[model samples]
Target: MNEIDPFKLFLELQLALPRNAPGSARATREAFSLLPALPPRPEIADLGCGQGAEAFELLRLANGRITAVDLFEPFLEKLAERAEREGVPETRLRVLRGDMNDLPFHDGEFDLIWSEGAIYLLGFEEGLRLWRRFLKPGGFAVLSELTWLTDAPSPEAAVFWEDAYPGMGSVASNGEAAARAGYRLIGRIVLPTEEWWQDYYMPMRAKLAGMRRTYGELPVFDEMEREICLFERHADEYGYVFYALRRD
Candidate 1:
């Protein structure tokens, strides 16, 4: 028998899960409500659109065009399949596969740029600064990021995140970065704990159980199991926070 590639297993676990991270349509709508009025048929870009859950929600809310960008071709294909299943018009939804750090669109191309649970691929501040040029003047940019909610987190949680995401910052610090990046901060919300479990963790838990049965014990799977246990124990210390901003 061939040894299973752990990274491939990780990718397989993520396949078909709605929303790559902890988010809900309700949260998406709430963030959209905080934005200033958008033009009719506005042009929006969803950076790192995983399976396009948020992208579809945006389509429903804005009645506008969406350019869904992702580095993974499979993810883009999944989004395209979903768009077709929902009877979304081709003219309204476009999927482009490309690196988030190097987007293919020209400068000032979109009225709104949105990313959910994917901004940390570029450090939050760097992503804001780099992507700002792609937004039309006064256009909005919204993203969700992992944030340190409390000043004092448990040592274990701190160590785990420091190893996993050293650039994570407090909400106030992120707000400061937004301001420094030339965006007027419009709104910020901490996603509820239920959002984390319901869509992401719960399903991931089930998948992990099945994988363990198939693969027995492996270091990669052990690491993921530990991460989940840590999250369940330390949810209060950290969370995904959505930030809404408009270019000045």
Candidate 2:
């Protein structure tokens, strides 16, 4: 028998979830509201737009056209389906399969760039600098990143994240990185724990249970379970933080 591909299994586990990370329509609107008035139907780009939860929210709030970019084709397909189901006009949303690091758009092409729970794939500071070129002067960029909430985290949480995301830093440090990347920090919002539970973890928990029944005993399953346990134990020490920035 052919061995199963664990990475493929991981992606399968994430499919069709409301969000791949913790966030809400409320949080997306809160970030957008901090921006200065946008031009009518401003151009926007959403990177790593998994299932386009934030993308749909952006369309609702700004009424802007969006180029939603992601590497996964399935996600883009799902976003397209959701867009149609919700009556988001085709002209308002365009789903593209592309890498965030090397976007296809030209310089200064977008009035706003938005990402949630995805910038970490490029490292926080690197993503800020690399993507800044795509923003028009005074254009806004909003992203939610994993951040250290407290100065000191518990040993278990620290170890897990150190292995998982060593680049993680406090919100203050992230703000400084934003400034260095030629963007002004407009505001920051700490995502409430309940949002994580409601949008991401709870659904993930249910999926994991089903996966366990099918996969039986896989190392990846164990690691995922451990992640859930760590969150339950150390949720207070760290969280996803939304940062609103403007190109200066």
TM-score of each: 0.97, 0.97
**Worst ten-residue run, lDDT, model 2?**
9-18
Clashing pairs in 1: none
- Model 1: weakest 10-residue lDDT segment is 10-19
lDDT of each: 0.91, 0.90
What tens digits encode model 1's per-residue C-alpha lDDT throughout 64-109?
8999999887788888888888898878998899898998888899
TM-score of 2: 0.97
Clashes of each: 0, 0
Cα TM-score of candidate 1: 0.97
Q: What residue pairs are clashing in model 2?
A: none
